[model samples]
Target: MSQATPPRSRRVPRAERREEILAAAARVFGSKGYRAGSLAEVAEQVGITHAGVLHHFGSKDRLLWEVLEYRDRVDVEHLEGQHIPGGLELFRHLVTTARRNADRRGIVQAYTVLTGEAVTDGHPAADRARTRFGVLREDIASALRTVADERGVDLAEQDAVRAASAVIGVMDGLQTQWLLDPEVVDLAESTAFAIEAILRAVLPGVEPLPDSPGASGAP
Candidate 1:
C-alpha cells in the first residue's frame, strides 16, 4: 500500500519565510550558543519540524551564517546607505552601532568562540572569521575616510584604517566587557563617550570650537 502525503498548511512567502527562520535562529542561538542550539528548537520556534528547518537552511552552520549575514546586511542598510552620515549624526551612528552589539550576543559569542577556536589553524570558522573581519575593517576605514572628507580634513588611508580599527575595537572590546559584566554598562552612552574622544583627537577644529554653532570656525 502507498503511504499518504502529509498535509501542507499555508506557506509563508519564500523570502519572508527565510527571514522568519533566521529570526528564530537568532533568538535560539542568543539563548544557547551556536553549538548548543538545536535545529529542532529553531524549527519549533517557527512552528515547523526539524527536517523542515534543515530543508530550508541545510544545516546548523548554514543557518548560523545566515544569521550573521542578516546582521551584516542590517548594518549596511542602516549605517552605510545612500544617506551619508555626517556631523554629530555620523558619530551617533557609530556609537549606536557599537552599542547595538550588546543586543547581538549570539553573533558576538560566535565571533569570540570562533576566534578562539581559529588559533588551532584548521578550525571551522577560522577562515570565515578572518575574511569577515578584513571586509568589515575595510568598510569601516572607507566610512572614516568619507567622514574626514566631509570635514575638509585630509587623512592618510593608513590613518583612516587605524581610526577604523580603533572604532571597531571599541565595539569588540565592549562586547567582551559586557559578556563579563552586563550590569557594568550602558553601551550606548559608553560608546558615545569613546567615539566622542576619538573624534576630538582626529577631527581637529570641530572639537575645541564648541559652546556655539558656527563658533568662529569652519570644518
Candidate 2:
C-alpha cells in the first residue's frame, strides 16, 4: 500500500541560509543601488520573510556592510596561498581578478555604488572604505617593494605608495568605464596595460606580462 508520503523538508542550516540571504542582498543591492534597495526584495529572492533577512543581519545598514565584507572575503580567498612575491605575478593576479569580475558584474556594481555613497559626510560604510583603501595601498606597496628588492632596484617608499594609489585609481576608473560601456572598455586588458606601463616606467628589467585577450600591446 502506498502509505503516507512524507512532507517535503524545508530546513536549511544557519550558515547556509545566511549565505543565501547575503547572495540575494548582493543581487538586489547591486541592481538597485543601496539607497534604493530593500530588504523585502532580498527576502523575496531568498524565499524568506523580511524579518528572516533581518534575523541574519539585524538591519539594512548592517546587511550592506556584511555584503561589502563578503565581497572582500571572496577576493582574499581568490588570492590566498598564491605567495606572489611581486611584479609580474601581482599584475597577473590583478588581471585574473578583472576577468573574474567580468562574470560577476553584480559584485562589481555593488562595490562601485557603495564607494560612491560612502563619500558622503556620514555613511555606514565610511570607516570600512577608509580601512579598505589603507590596506589595499599597503598590500600593493609590499608587492612593489618585493619586486624592487629582487631586481636590485631602488624605489623610494613614497614612490611606491604613490604607484599603489595610482594602480587602484586606474583599476577603479577602468571598472566604471567597463560597467558603463563594456564594448568600449575591456577591463582586464586595459588594466593590464595600465599596470604594465607603470611597472616598465618605474622598474626597469620588469618582465613583460603575458598576452591576454584584452591587452593589445602595452605602451
lDDT (CA) per prediction: 0.66, 0.75
Across 1-219, the per-residue lDDT of candidate 2 in tens digits comes to 112211225578899888877877777876676567899988877777898888999998778878877765655453546333355567666776676666667667767877888989988678988998898788888888888988889999888999889888888889899989999999878988888887776688687676433433332
For candidate 1, the per-residue lDDT at 38 reads: 85
lDDT of 1 by residue, 146-183 (tens): 76788788878777777767877776676667777778
Please report the candidate that would top TM-score against the real structure: 2
Instruction: Name the best candidate (by lDDT).
Output: 2
CA lDDT, candidate 1, residue 48? 71
TM-score of each candidate structure, all chains considered together? 0.73, 0.77
User: Which residue pairs show backbone clashes in model 1?
Assistant: none
